[model samples]
Target chain A: MDEQRFLEYVQSGGQVETTDRMPDDYRSKLVKFIEMHGNSELMGVLPEREWILRAPTLQRKLALTAKVQDEVGHSQLIYRVVEDLGKPREQCLADLISGKSKFHNVFHYPTKTWGDVGVIAWLVDAAAIISQKALLKCSYAPYARIMKKICWEESFHILHGRDVVLTMMNGTDEQRELVQEALNRWWGPLMQFHGNPISKEDDPMYIWRIKSQGNEEARQQFLDGYVPQIWELGLTVPDPKLRKSDDGVWEYSEPDWDELKHVVTGHGPKTQERLEFRRKFLEQEAWVRSVVLAEAA
Target chain B: MSEKVQKIVEIADDELILGWRDSEWTGIAPSLEEDVAFSSIAQNEIGHARALYELAARELGTDADTLAFDRDPGEYLSAPLVEERRMDWAHTIARHFLYETADEIRLAALKDSDDAEVAGLAAKMDREEQYHRLHARMWRDRLQDEPRFVDALEELWPAAVAVLPEELRPQMSERLQLDLPSNSLLRGFERGSHSEELRPLLDEMTMVRRSVPGATW
Candidate 1:
């Protein structure tokens, strides 16, 4: 198929499979978009994995472990999709570690305390799920199909996050303080979690129908759904201008788009540390992969 | 402690510590598939630990979380085998395979316990462990010829034997087709003594709980 026809096909809500023919632009765009997602899931694991060993109870420990496992599982599922798109998983990792590719801005920051854990699962995941839910309508059939499972598991993470926050809120003053302090640190990145409010017409991801909504639309959905939940728990959002307008649109201070650009481009505080950590493990375990793959061959 | 409670806590400690060790691989396993698969095994082990602790809690008038997180490091009854911090994949898998093998024998005996509750829980745990055993065996098969894996299995054999009781050692030896070492050699790694690693593991494990004592997480 020619470029215009392929664009028209996806524009009309038509789905494309791996075997389907398409323009180079759409295929390359799809691979880049999806590969970043896979990288995010893998890199996202580090911040939370630090807290798994320190979970306050057996139930929390098991739940945290399972949640981290789900993220890793999501990475596996996502990398497989990328691999099917003609970019191998190994190359994706190498690029990610070498800082040649990007992941979401949120994961590049540090996870400071137990409170950071709760906020991340609750708020960060809430932001991510909004985008992921939009992807359920992706013009790529396989990626869209996998989003069903990813979104379902993500719902559980949101619940787990909310429960952690609620429990701490109901506990002592010190615990409540922990939640507030963490919220303060995380709110900036949370606002920047969705990219700048780029117009759908101008966004290639939207043009190709890889993402069904504009950046602003997804951010609005997150604010509308979660701001009330955060309020009900008596936790404060760091943004002063964060509120709903009379017309039902969310009006907020502009996020630090420069920081988002910088971080996702691999300059966030924890980016080098996290990428180095992943690089260390990948290199250390290279022999294990070689042995296993060689024997399987 | 009652003999039954002592037995329960011992098994619970092993699962708890070993699960803790296994979970260290959650995000950093050799491959993404292994990361996910190995994490499930870790979670299942912790789940088994919780169930076992809950059963013992009923007899001792405590809660599972308290038993799991509030105990002193010196009081932890985990075997030295599970306490060693071997983060590399080969040692991780070697411990996984050996611990699962030992646990299989221990759970089988528990399933036949005269106490109906103990036997029932053991039966349930055994079902979950079937998958864990399969996972361990699959890795063992894949890496059997690798020298590092073979060396790990050899180095960990005595500690693996120490995981079982004297009567159970023979069964484990038979199952693995390896001779049990002398009891004298296994005593140092046996239960009832905490490995130096357990203190730091417990300190990190209980830091959040300790930060705000008696406050519900």
Candidate 2:
């Protein structure tokens, strides 16, 4: 199919299969977007996996481990799609660690407390699930199909997150403070999680139908679903201007677009450290893979 | 604690701590396929620990969570082999293979325990360990020729032997097909010795609960 025709096809809700022909730009963009997502899920594990060891209770430990495992599985599914699209998993990893690619902004920050843990699961995951659900209609059929399973698995993460947050809310004043403090620290990054506002027509991801929701729309959805949940627990958002409008738009202090730009471009406080950690582990295990996948006689 | 309860706690602690170590690889294993399969093993270990704890909890008049989190590090009976925070992949896999091998032998003994409760639980846990063994064996075969993996297994061999009762050591040694080292088997550490790692882990793990000491969370 011609480039213009392919664009029209996707715009009109046509699904592109792996076997289908497409413009080089579309395939390249799909790989880049999906690879970054896979990278995000892989890097995301570093911030939370430690908690599995320190999980205060058996139930919490087990639940968190399972959740983290699910994220790993999701990344696996994602990378396989990327691999089929032309980039090898090794090349993707190299690009990720070499600072040639990007991951989501939120994972670049640190997880400071168990309250941070709860916040990540409850609010952060809720925000992510909103975006992921939108991708269920991704024009790339394989990516879209895997998203179905991802969205399904994420349903449990939301429940687990809500349960943790609810439990903390019902607990002592210090516990409640933990959640509030986490929210305060996380609000800026969370606001930027969906990226800065761009018109659907202008945003390539939206234009290509890889991302069905616009950035502002995703942020508003996050607010509509979660802001009330936060308020109900007597927690205050750091932004005073944050409020839902009569027409249902979420009004808030404009996020630090510069900071988002800075962080996503590899200057986040914890970006280098987290990437280095992943790189170190990957290097250490390189021998195992060499031997494991070595030609069987 | 009753005799039966104490015995179960010993085993439960071992499984819980080992599961924690295994779960460390959830997001960062050698491959995605191995990550998923390995994670299921980790979850299964925790599940086995929970079951054993519940059995003990009934006699101790407490619940599983309380037994899991409320205990002082010194009170835990997990072997040092499972408690070391080795992030190195070679050491990690070595310990994994060794522990699964030893655990299978111990579970076999327990499957025949005179106590019906212990025997039944061991039987159930054994079935789950079956998958764990398959995974470990798969990795061991793959990594056997690698120098780093061989070194790791040799270094950790003694510690793996200590994970079981004295009488079962021979069986474990036979399964591992290695000579019993002259090095002293690490013991007594289970109840009194803990890696410095436990304190920090507990700090993060309990941060939320500690913040609201009497609260529901």
Top DockQ prediction, candidate number? 1
Q: After superposition, how far is residue A52 of candidate 1 from its true place, in Å?
A: 1.0
TM-score, each model?
Answer: 0.98, 0.94
Q: Which ten residues in a row have the lowest lDDT in candidate 2 chain A?
A: A288-297
lDDT of 2: 0.85
lDDT tens digits, residue span B1-217, model 1: 9999999999999999999988999999999989988889889889999999999999999999989988778778889999989989889989999999999999999999999999999999999999999998999998898899999999899999999888889899899999888777776798887678888888888889999888999
Residue A297 error, candidate 1, Å: 1.2
Structure candidate 1, residue pairs in collision: none
**Model 1 Cα shift for residue A117 (angstroms):** 1.1
C-alpha lDDT of residue A61 in model 1:
94
